[model samples]
Target: MSQETAEPGIEASAKTAEIEALKDTFRNVPGLAGAPMIMAPALAETFATHQHELGVRVHPDLAVKKFIAPFRGPRDAFNPSGDYGAIDTPATPIPVLPNMREYTPHELEVIVGQLRDMGVVNDPEPPRDVAHVVTD
Candidate 1:
């Protein structure tokens, strides 16, 4: 006797559709423009978690570059004033990386806090108290 395999259920199809829709959404979210590699489980998980509102997987390697002249150059990379700011400053090369890892929301918050303390961003405060209390 020959046996026939069962087709996938509606639930599986629906889940697949949902995942596809999420992939589309992930593509549109800014700052997430990177190749999606299936072999990288961490990257895949991270992309899904941050972009799909799903569980987070491993943290992916996100590349970044910063101005090197100010941090490292003797104003040597590019003289914005001298060159009329026409030339772009050279950026620092990639820094040594640690084992790929994931960041919890709490860890992210801590990183953000440290960045703000380092003046990378401004602290959230009441907006200048723009409105006068106007107490008589």
Candidate 2:
């Protein structure tokens, strides 16, 4: 006996339409002129989680070169001064952090405290007292 497969529901069709609309939006962004229309399979889930938490989505197929310069010049890899120094050397690749959620609350607190001690404040306090302006 032959069996017929079920068609996609209304919800699925709506989601597909939304995704297509998003893809069209990404294609039209100024700086992202040539970014891919679809996210990579490996990054799909991670990016979806990011969108869920941050309410923003990044194009997965965006080229790294667009954001970072290629390393092929006489400038020092650690620090560059001018346009020639804009490129980053392979010796000092950008650092990627692991998921912070994996850390225990105590571990996160310790990390934040250490960073704060080292002069890294997430939210700096604003000046309280404002001097009154005198009109001549």
Writing each residue's lDDT as its tens digit, candidate 2 over 72-123 gives 4433222222121222323444346689899999999999998888888665
Cα lDDT of model 1 by residue, 11-85, tens digit:
577555555444433321223344222223344345554654554222213313212333332342123211111
Off by over 4 Å in 2: 1-92, 122-136
lDDT of each: 0.44, 0.47
lDDT of 2 at 26: 30
Worst 10-residue stretch by lDDT in candidate 2?
Answer: 77-86
**Best-fitting candidate, scored by TM-score:** 2
Model 1, position 54, has a per-residue lDDT of 55
Return the TM-score for candidate 2, rounded to 2 decimals: 0.25
The clash numbers for all candidates, in the given order, read 0, 0
